[model samples]
Target: MTSAPPRVLTVAGSDSGGGAGIQADLKAMLANGVHGMSVLTAITAQNSLGVQGAWELPAEQVEAQFRSVVDDIGVDAVKTGMLASADMVRVVAALLRTLPPEVPVVVDPVAVSKHGDALLGAEAMEAVRSEVVPLATVLTPNLTELGPVAGVELRTVQDRELAAKILLDAGASWVLVKGGHDGGDTAVDVLHGPGTRQEFSAPRADNRHTHGTGCTLASTIASYLARGYDVPSAVGAAKQYISGAIANGFALGGGIGPVDHAWQFRGSGQ
Candidate 1:
């Protein structure tokens, strides 16, 4: 028999809308050719419009789910999103510390949903900045997330680099600063790590169906890492993948829709 596909595990909240959080992460992982697993941190009552309700899982439950996956199936890489509280962040961080150092961890510092729904609380933000963030192998933070995590409002290219530097100093081995909110003709994302810096740019797709772009991008990166790609290559490929996904995005509900995860295998070959 052939060997199993690389496995990528996501620890995050579940989006009932199936557009973001754990749902999007798993979809992205599968699209990127990895076996996806999840430890649901919270259950969300959400739709295209926004998140209506959210209930965090008990820390014990989160631990159990994580242990069940890592202790048995094991993980080649990990990604995190929408941790509901500071306690949850700490718990996940501690667990991540126990993983093999070779396993890359992509941390999507998800603070708010595309519809402006607050997914992470203020108190939890501190925990992310102090605990969860420092453990990231590759920290993927969009414009809005970069500001809160790095303690600076990023507007210009210089500002974005400054924010990335702050995150790098904070302990992530690398930082990918997403510039989707820059309102430009080109969508740009910068990847920065020790003695290395690169920018990946794609023509901005004028699509409003971009609800889960952040989660999808981060998950794609983690999946690539699980497949044995290095950080720069993983981030570059994920950028291209997400660019195509955004272009292929289609409207679903009355509100924002999600990025198309399967654009590559849909015959167009992306």
Candidate 2:
């Protein structure tokens, strides 16, 4: 019998648009040859335009979901995004602390959507900075979202590396500071902490259908981690995967769309 694929769990919010949040995380996991699982922290009324509404799941429900999965299916790695509230962040952090610390955790502290919708509140930002990031195996934050969590205002690529340093100092074993939001010819992401310092650069794909790029990157990284790849290698491969996902992304709605997660499935063997 064929064995099941490695499992990767994402504890995040639901994106109704199916572009970002848990939807994108699961898709990326599957594309990278992993079994995907989720523990949703909130439900987002998201669209290509923006997030219209959001409802956070009760802390009890979040804990129940975590226990249900970790107690049975058991994940090799996990990625987190969009906790929605301070209480939710704290709850997830506590639960994660009880897990085997060796299980890699990719924390994507999603503060805002690609369409500029506010996904995280100001109060919750502090919780993420203080509680969530401390347990992260690798913290992936976009340039716009980096300041609150990493506490470094960025103006250039050098600034982004400094921001990564701040997050590493904050307790993450590694920091992957995404430089896509910064206007540039290359989309750069840097990972540095402990004994690993890795940098990824891809020539800008010039695609507007970039709504869920951040989610895809973090999920891909976690999936690789689940498969037993080390931090630098995992981040490097994920960078390549997401860049191609962006290059071939298809437009679906009037506003921003999502990356093409299944690109590797195309073409006959050569």
Candidate 3:
């Protein structure tokens, strides 16, 4: 028989909107050819418009869920997003530390949602920096997440590089500072790591249905990492995948829609 697909896990919140959070993560993982699993940290009553309500699971529940999956199934790679509280962050970080170092971890510091809802609390900021971020094999931070995460002002690409250094100092092996918020014809992201710095640029997709881009990108990277790609290679391929998803994003709710996770299969009419 053919080998089984790589197993990837996402430890994050649940998005009822089905656009971002755990929903988007699983979809992206499947699109990238990985077996996806999840451990929900919070539940959000959300839609394309905004997050109407949210409730975080207790630390004990979060810990239990993580142990259940990781102890039994075992994952090749993992991605984290939308940890609602400081306690949750601490628990997840502690568990990650115990995992085999070979398993790559992609941490998406999801502080805010696409509709401007606060997914992570202010109190959790320090936990993210001190607890969560340090365990990341690849840390993916968007423009909004960069300043708060690194505690520095970011404007130009140079500024992001500086902020990346701060995160690097915090112990993340690699950092990808996403520049999709910047004004330009092309979207640029800088990956900063040991002895090398690289930039990945793609044409900006002019679609409003680009919700969940960050989640999709991070999850896709984790999926690739599960399939045995190195940090740079995983990030590069994931960027290409998300670019297509963004370009193919179609309208759904009254506000922004979601990036099509199945964009790769759509053009062929499959």
User: Tens digits of per-residue lDDT for model 2 on 1-270?
Assistant: 999899999999999999999999999999998999999999989888889999999988999999999999998999999888899999999999988978999999998889888888878988998898889998998878987777666677677777777777778888888879767799888778887666799999878998889889999999999998988889989998998898888788889988888877863211
lDDT of each: 0.91, 0.88, 0.91
Is 1 or 2 the stronger prediction by TM-score?
1
Q: After superposition, how far is residue 45 of candidate 1 from its true place, in Å?
A: 0.8
Each prediction's number of clashing residue pairs: 0, 0, 0
Residues 1-270 of candidate 1 have per-residue lDDT tens digits of 998999999998999999988999999988889999999999999989999999999999999999999999999999999897889999999999999988899999999889998777778887898897788999998888888888887667788789888889989899998889888799989889999899999999988999899999999999999998999999989998999999988788899988899888785533
Off by over 4 Å in 2: 155-158, 267-270
Model 3 spans with C-alpha error above 4 angstroms: 268-270
Name the lDDT value of residue 170 in candidate 2: 76
All candidates' TM-scores? Answer: 0.96, 0.95, 0.97
What lDDT would candidate 3 get against the real structure?
0.91
If candidate 3 were superposed on the true structure by all CA atoms, what would the RMSD be?
A: 1.5
RMSD to the hidden true structure, all candidates = 1.4, 2.1, 1.5
Off by over 4 Å in 1: none
